[model samples]
Target: MELQNRREFGKKMLGTTLNYFLLESLFTSQAFASSVRPVATHWAKQLTEICNDLKLQKIPPVLWQQQVEKLFNQIELPELLKFIDFETLTRGFDYPDLGVNTRMVKFPKLDGLPEKTVFIRKIFGMKKGRAIIPHGHSNMSSAHLVLKGEFALKHYDKVAEEDKYLLIKPTIEKTAGVGSSSSVSDEKNNIHWFIANTETAFTFDVIMVDLGGKAYDIHNIDIAAGEKAGNGLIRAAKLDVETALKKYGKQHH
Candidate 1:
């Protein structure tokens, strides 16, 4: 009986292990994994210290909607095209019950922008919650737009590295209210990280611009407060506000 129990336990463990490996593989691509090195060196190495002191605040939804709508109206799509580079925007995941999707769009005639690469799409259910992991990117800048719902966004700056990715730092938490958006441009060096802080789920939209190439990269990072409970890869992205403004904000700016 003892021998039989041991065999069954071993079989179950193996099955579980195999299932996990398959799921991870299905979600992550080899190209995306290799892209991490550049993001780590560029954003993590350059801005990790300076941004540590920066804090974040919340923006209300009505104000957010008005601002984005105003910016879109003043900025013509073609004029907006000049600063346009790789665009990746996602919306969804506020309630957990709603489905989500991520899409990539590329433009060639934009001039000075990379060819055959860019991601543009509507996303849903790709983000949620208040607590997120601290992370940085290599060659991307991002703009987050909240089409609907209310949310709190906390910004964090990496202070020190416990080990390659295990970060220790002070955080700046802010709320993006509802219908509002926040953008971070990639400095020649610095990038910022953030998380959602709403009680229930909220819906929002985001646009990510890849400055370097068609590929986007993110490092799986863990933070001090969120680590104890094992919430890994909760918050992350590829780009900063400055880059967002310079490359894509001409219409709004």
Candidate 2:
């Protein structure tokens, strides 16, 4: 009987140790995931699909987000937690252009829209005529929400492609109607470029929706001399709201 009691105690101790180990492992995994960036490919593919659908079908962004939220909510918590929170990433970059004099705060998740991937980004002390370099998404598209000042966006298309040089030209396609949102097959207007203009250093929000799974998609092309007409341009487009404001300010002031 004494031996039986000892065996029972041993079993209980073993169980307790196992429970502790499991809890520790869970905590460690959560910590690891929180620190890691989301895999770019997974998020970029989905986001690209969304952009194409919106541009082609003329579907509203809000409605698209709703559908995405539903799909993402079904993802396991471990996978869902992999994203870098906007507030967190903002703190890492130092922006003097947007007059971001204060620390950034992650926009709180709206109660019903738990799956919407939204962020409120700020660039402090920004001004007009500043240069925004060319870049492209290996997988995403972004929208600038003018929270504070005005911004100008110039979309460029690759006019020519060459092994030695990259040639590009600017084009503006007014995205006013529904069909504008649905057409994604031809994204010639969605190429490489930059942004800049004149405005007071201020802050604005950029809603960077993922195209596949990456943070930013930058495609930098090299426009070399003697390149054939068919291949003379490199394209990298950027959207900075502050640049738009600068243009507006110049016109009014």
Candidate 3:
């Protein structure tokens, strides 16, 4: 009876050990599967289709932005990074004096498309407290994706105009981090400001320029703290580049 009991205990120990190994193997397989990189050509093909649709459909600004956002959502960050030349993109960041810098990813121009088909892709590298000052786009649609670190995004709608001041109502405000994305169009959330909330941050942007017009213009606006309307929209004054930078420049270390 003693021998029989010892054998039963041994069997139980073996069963527990086997179960642990089986579970670990299953988890290892899953981790390896998720780490596999996607086919790079697939993204190129998808981008081509999006650009072609934009040219053919000439969709409304809001709808066009939605389509672009949907397509971008399908791509993973690792897969998208495959197309960018990080060595060139990070060159400026290597030097401290450059401060905040933006570099474009060189992509082959979409062939067999009309001259109006415009594609612009860029990466912005910034230090803490640096900002892309409040600005609005004209005749353009774009998307901003946070690749690393955190950012504060504030968006506003142009509601009323008073001389040089534009009455803008705050629309959306949120904190975004890795894998997060936001979009803009002439009709929705047209004006926005972005500030880095970490020691360093990187953001990628894809822009379709002059979708329905000749040129796309970015107009920067100054916040009017003293001017507020009953409707909740605040007044903003436009500022030149020099003045805007002085007002919104990054904090010094």
Which one is best on lDDT? 3
Best by TM-score: 3
Query: Residue-wise lDDT of candidate 1 within 84-161, one digit each (tens)?
Result: 221233222233222123334332222233342222333332334422233554444444544434555544443333
Q: Name the candidate, 2 or 3, with the larger TM-score value.
A: 3
Model 3 spans > 4 angstroms off: 1-41, 55-57, 92-99, 108-117, 161-163, 224-226, 251-253
Q: Which ten residues in a row have the lowest lDDT in candidate 3?
A: 108-117
Model 3 score (lDDT): 0.72
List model 3 lDDT by residue over 96-202, tens digit each.
Answer: 22235788776533333233335787888888888787877777778888887898889988775555677788898999888888888778888888888898888
Off by over 4 Å in 2: 1-105, 115-125, 150-152, 159-167, 173-188, 192-195, 201-216, 221-253
TM-score of each: 0.37, 0.37, 0.73
Whole-model Cα lDDT of every candidate shown, in order? 0.38, 0.40, 0.72
Local distance difference test, candidate 1: 0.38
Sliding window of 10 residues with minimal summed lDDT for model 1 = 48-57
Clashes of each: 34, 64, 0
lDDT, model 2 = 0.40
